[model samples]
Target: MKILVVDDEEDVKSLFEQKFRKEIRNAQFEFSFAFSGEEALTYLADHPSEVVMILSDINMPGMSGIELLKSIRKDYPAAPPQVMMITAYGDSQNHNQAMQLGADDFLTKPVNFIELKEKLLKTL
Candidate 1:
């Protein structure tokens, strides 16, 4: 599966690469990184039907993940890519908002790789 990971943190790319190294080596998941929500939109625009899922950080600098989620839901209402929002703050307000905006799932940061892998497998 092709997954787009969006976050403001530059280290996120390396972290994901390290965490999912085995799956990547096995060709189970293909990942693309975007440093910002705007960049994620650009990537999505360029590769409309390529991405199967998006893992986005909710508290970004410019456009927040909630805003990104809203835009994606609005733009691709028919067949939107599955979106899972991640955040350091596990507040109900953020979680509720994301759920209302059509988020497929919500994950709290310091993410549990084991849980994430299980969820990804379920999707497959």
Candidate 2:
């Protein structure tokens, strides 16, 4: 399965890639990255089912993760990907909004790689 890890931070992107490298060998996961939500959408439009899950940072420049989730839920309703929102703050309002927008899960910053892996496992 393929997973899209979306975040503005370079370190987070690098960490996710490194952490999932071994799993990629087994085809347990193939990873992709998007520095912003709009880029993520563009990537999805081009690759479609190549992605199974989207791990996104909530606060981003062009489009927030919330916007990305809503767009997918609406435009790709038939098989919208499971979105896992990531943020540094645990804002209840954003959390509720994410849920309403169809996010499958949420994670705070300083992403725990192990937990992220398990969550992706559940969705895949």
Query: lDDT of each structure?
Result: 0.95, 0.84
TM-score of each: 0.97, 0.92
Candidate 1 local lDDT, 2-113, one digit each (tens): 9999999999999999999999999999999999999999999999888999999999999999999999998887778999999999999999999999999999989999
Candidate 2 on 1-124: residue-level lDDT in tens?
A: 8888888877776787678878887888888898988899999999977788888899988898888888888878877777888898898998898888788888887878888778777766
Global lDDT for candidate 1? Answer: 0.95
Backbone collisions counted per model: 0, 0
Candidate number with greatest TM-score:
1
Q: Give candidate 2's whole-model lDDT.
A: 0.84
